[model samples]
Target: MKPESALVLEELRSKLRPASVAQVGGFRPGADPLTSWFLKGVCLPGEGLPVWKGQPMFPLIQIRTDELPVIPEQLKGIALLVLFHNREHHPFDQPHGEGWLIREYATLEGLELLPELETPYHPFPVRWVSVNDDAPGWEDAWDIIDLSEVNDDTQASDSFFDDFNRYGGTKVGGYPMEIQHSVGIKDFVFQVGSEEKVNWMWADNGIGYFHRSAEGIWQFSCQFY
Candidate 1:
């Protein structure tokens, strides 16, 4: 990892306390062993830190240690830009419209860190964009900017699809363009207004999704890889 990336990870570990553990490889419960181990090895439990949905939640963290030879030096700086966001549906308390959190971490530096890695492991690049009431229009929130627009074109073949596939999960066999992705972590709502308030939502990619529904309510959700 790059110096800045490592510093940020270390800082995040120190600042955010792990509420719940998640497993990465096998079928163990609680938290992923690798992720749990990484968190335990880095940051210890603390008080007063923000918890995921009033419970403990651990966001996936990817660190490129020297042991991983496949990681390219060019991709070291990419990890620093990892972003996470919350998804909420209308009517707040409906089961059919599940409200959860989704995180998307991209190496916006234009480097494919681990090419050989498979699903849930591929390292894609992403950037952070926020759409708010201040934005020119609400529709601008739906625009997910492609990183290739600013990076080199050499690594551009099927990158977005590969990214969406990796994060969203393998495409279901017969579905036209519908993809299914897992909700790795739940989101905590930080209200920004009163009974009628503006809540800003951000995604792991650093982009914010916002919309104005009927009755002046501002709704937001993050779209991830």
Candidate 2:
């Protein structure tokens, strides 16, 4: 009966313990918090709006496997496996059967296969994939990638709500951008468990909360303070 989004968060936190991680800033409540800032660099300049060049919108959680204080039990085995099969094998990319299959799926579908709620009018479709015998460890890989980004030092902009209050904002020396309620950092919540309690209580004070949406996608919402 737990909310699906909370489950996702807990799973990652547990697995990546002792790793210094933080959530990048930029997610404003109702905004698409998970939207990757990397997309800005991908787009050509002068074609669209210049990327938000402000401080990173998200936290920086860098992990050096060699430096971890307490590596996950399963990961140790994985490292050993890589050590034994250095030339032909890779983490999650065994040269043989299902490992290879899952690796291929991860490369081609992992991002799209997030366990999320369905949505309409989104830039991308929200679909959930179950992990069963056929796919044993795929979820773990995604969890690592996601949790590694959560950090205590990352900071978000207070201007998000201000921008929304005004209904728009102009990028520094750039074109004007319209901020909408549906996309602003309001009207959103990140709660956990069957009771659906907010992960970050006092929604107006903390950085934000994250929860699986009614449609199943992992969504982030900012507090109002």
Candidate 3:
């Protein structure tokens, strides 16, 4: 944890009800990986209110990739936006794919809350798309323009959570770098598997890959945008 995050966690303990914190993100089929990617921006107080016991809960919102509003001017040139989620039962391990798909869809739906910045500037647009290992042809892959070069370091710290917490209860600390903006789609691919085996894509830098492992685990991998 970063020094700043520790301070925030301490503060959360002071202000909100006590709750357990669990890691949420992609995991390998059978064994748990050392590090799990997380949803960075969304946070909640108490697990029940959101009806889900996961960290970095995704709020109900609608998103359409084909018709995204103008990138929020504020985040226009930012490098990355990390997102998080709470742990859940292994979907693939279960019998039918229905339960797993529903849960996974909910997580993706919750992602909408993270990009709710002043209109015309969102971190990146994401959606479910087919993916394979061969280098994606233009029509086959999604395009994520790089803005890391244009971002101003001073403004990077300007967080939406600061305002998000004002309406809902606040968490003590902010997002972790691993969950925030550090990891990207590439990292997720290496962690999970490549397109030949996986069935997802890297939208911008975030994880949005989908595939199943030979061991029978239904897997979906992604990082924050």
Reference-based TM-score of each model: 0.20, 0.17, 0.18
Instruction: Write the candidate numbers in order of decreasing lDDT.
Output: 3, 1, 2
TM-score pick, better of 1 and 2: 1
Per-residue lDDT tens digits of candidate 2, residues 131-178? 111110222234233422323212211211121122111001101112
TM-score between model 2 and native:
0.17
Model 2, position 112: C-alpha lDDT score: 25
Task: Candidate 2: list runs displaced more than 4 Å.
Answer: 1-20, 23-206, 213-216
Give the higher-lDDT candidate: 1 or 2: 1
**TM-score, cand. 3:** 0.18
For candidate 1, give the lDDT.
0.23
Q: What is the lDDT of residue 26 in candidate 2?
A: 30
Query: Listing every candidate in turn, what is its Cα RMSD in Å to the true structure after a full C-alpha superposition?
Result: 19.2, 22.0, 20.9
Model 1 alpha-carbon drift over 4 Å, by segment: 1-41, 44-50, 59-62, 72-225
Q: Per-residue lDDT tens digits of candidate 3, residues 193-223?
A: 1122122223433333333333423344344
Query: What is the C-alpha RMSD, rounded to one decimal, of candidate 1?
Result: 19.2
Q: What is the lDDT of residue 210 in candidate 3?
A: 33
lDDT of 3 at 69: 26
